[model samples]
Target: MKLTILGCYSATPRILTNPTSQVLEMRGNMFLIDCGEGTQVQLRKHKIKFSRIKHIFISHLHGDHFFGLVGLVSTFRLLGREADLHIYGPKGIKEIITLQMKLADSWTNYNLIFHELTSNDSELIYEDDKVEVYTIPLEHRVYTNGFLFKEKEGNRKLDINAVEEANIDVAYYRKLTQGFDVVNENGETIKNEDVTKDAVKPKSYAFCSDTMYKEDIVPLIENVDVLYHESTFLETQSHLAPKTKHSTAKEAASIAKKANAGTLLLGHYSTRYKDVNCFKEEAKEVFQAVELTQDGKVFEF
Candidate 1:
């Protein structure tokens, strides 16, 4: 799994920074996490094909989180994209997009599917053969949710030498890879473990942004391989975190520690501070495996 941060700044765009937007590449899927303003430009700058992004997950209706969605949809139409686009976001997201299209008298040529979420409980919103995406209900000024991406267990690998030594036919290799015992022509039961090794360990990524310091989310994101949490403030300015419904760098690190995440990625920084190194320094005090995110930075796991 890999994550490319197209934008990471909070609230508004700056000369050198952008708002919330990222592209998560995993299991042959490119998921756009947010559509903050200038997202398309950032995608272009990063040389990511717009059509490759089939699904977009919006955390909330906040302008900094989803302001560029309509423009991206329209761009797809102009590019003559035929593939369907799926968007998962808070309730009323469809209405908001449709209204924009209606006002502009321009509709997308490609299919636009919206999965609006309203339930407060964490729920599975998307799934495929290789991956699953779940909503992480968040506490923010509005109805918001982060996303949890988990890779499914792949098929076990077959030990060709072992299979051949056991006189196993190629036809039964498929069954063996599926972890099934097979009956040979000699009526002998060949155990799956005898022919195949274990499958690769699955990896998971949790995205938590535009939310306050909510400890309840720790259980949902426990043991995640990579966690991206928003740290809109520093501990010195922690007083503003709860008031603004955001989290401090220390708070984000605390969540990472509580969840036992393998690595913590901090982003969505407030523009008030010019130096982002402090965020990483403070977070590392609590969670050693913490990294600060920058626009256009890429992380692979």
Candidate 2:
């Protein structure tokens, strides 16, 4: 799995920084995490094909998180895209997009599907053979949710030497890989464990933004391979975190430590601080595997 940060700054876009937007590439799927303003431009700058993004997940109705959605949809129409686009977000997202289209007298040529979420509970939103996406209910000024992307367990590997010794037919190899015992032509029972090896463990990634330092999320994101959490303030300004429903760098790191995440990626930084290195420095005091996100940085796992 790979994640490309299209934008990472908080609140607004500037000449060198952008708001919250990211592209997660996994299991042959490209998922747009947020549509903050200037997301399309950042996508283009990073050479990520807009057409490859089939699903979009919006954390909340906050403009910094979803203001560029309408423009992106319109761009797809202008590009003559025929493929369907799926958007999962907070409730009323469909109404918001439809209203924009109605006001502009412009509708998308492609199919636009919306999965509006109103429940505060963590629920599975998307699932396929390779991956699953779940909503991570969050505490914010407005209704918000983070997303957890987890890879499914893969098929077991067949032990060719053991299969040959057991005289297992090629036709039964598929069953062996599936961890199923098979009966041979000789009426012998071939055990799956004797001819198969365990598959590699799957990895998971979590995305949390525009939320406060809520420890309840630790269980949901426990042991994630990578965690992208918003750190909108420095430790010195921690007093503002709860008031603004955002987390400071140290608070985000604490959550990461509690969750036992492999890597803690801090982003959605406040623009007041010109040096983003300070955020990383503050987070490292609590979590060793801390990394600061830039507008176009990529992380592969």
Candidate 3:
């Protein structure tokens, strides 16, 4: 899995920094997460193809999280896009986008599909053969959700020498790799485990931003390989966290420690601080593996 941070600041876009937006590339699919202002420009700056993004995920109705949605869809029309675009977001998202389009008399040329979510409980939102996505309900001023992306395990690896010695025909190689027991040329049943090794362990990523410190989400993201949590404030300004419905770096680290996440990534920083590395230091107090995020940073796992 590959993730490119288009923008990671909070509330407003700046000349040097931007709001929340990111792109995740997994299994030949590109997922645009949270289209803040200037997102398309960031995508262009990063040289990521607009056509590669078929699915867009919006965490909430907050302006910093989804203000760029209509602009992006209109751009797709300008480019003469033909492929369908799927948008997963809050319940009123469709109405909000449609109203603007109606007033401007500008409609998309491509199919626009919206999967509006209202459930408070965790649920599967998207799935295919190679990947699965689930919603992680979050606590914020507005109805919000985080996203979990998990890769599906592939077929097992074959031991060529063992298969040949077992008198298995080449025609049954596919079945062997699929973890199926098949009859050999000698009329003997071969066990899949005996000839094939286990497949590569699948990877998982969980993204939780623009939320207060909530323990309920820990179970949903337990043992996640990578976790990107919002650290909008530091402990020195921790008093502002609850009041503003945002999390401190220490709070984000506590969540990561409790969830047993492999690596904790810190982003959505408040512009009040001159140095963002302080977030990483405060987070490292509770979690050892901590990484800081900025615009144009890329992470591979």
CA lDDT, every model vs. true structure? 0.95, 0.93, 0.95
What shift in Å separates residue 125 of candidate 2 from its native position after superposition?
Answer: 1.0
TM-scores, all candidates, are: 0.97, 0.94, 0.96
lDDT of 3 by residue, 77-139 (tens): 899999999999999999999999899999898999999999999999999998999999999
Candidate 1 off by > 4 Å = 184-187
Worst 10 residues of 1 by lDDT: 183-192
How much is the lDDT of residue 13 in candidate 2?
A: 80
The root-mean-square deviation over C-alpha atoms between each candidate and the true structure, in angstroms, is: 1.3, 1.7, 1.4
Top TM-score prediction, candidate number: 1
* Per-residue lDDT of candidate 2, residues 53-116 (tens digit): 9999999999899999989999999999999999999989999999999999999888999999
Residue 103 error for model 2, in Å? 2.1
In model 3, the number of clashes is 0
Ranking by TM-score: 1, 3, 2
Error of 2 at 108 (Å): 1.5
Error of 1 at 6 (Å): 0.6
lDDT of 1 at 111: 92
What are the per-residue Cα lDDT tens digits for candidate 1 across 40-148?
A: 9999999999989999999999999999999999999999999999999988999999998999999988899999999899999999999999999999999999999
Query: How far off is residue 148 in model 2, in Å?
Result: 0.8
- How does residue 179 of candidate 3 score in lDDT? 93
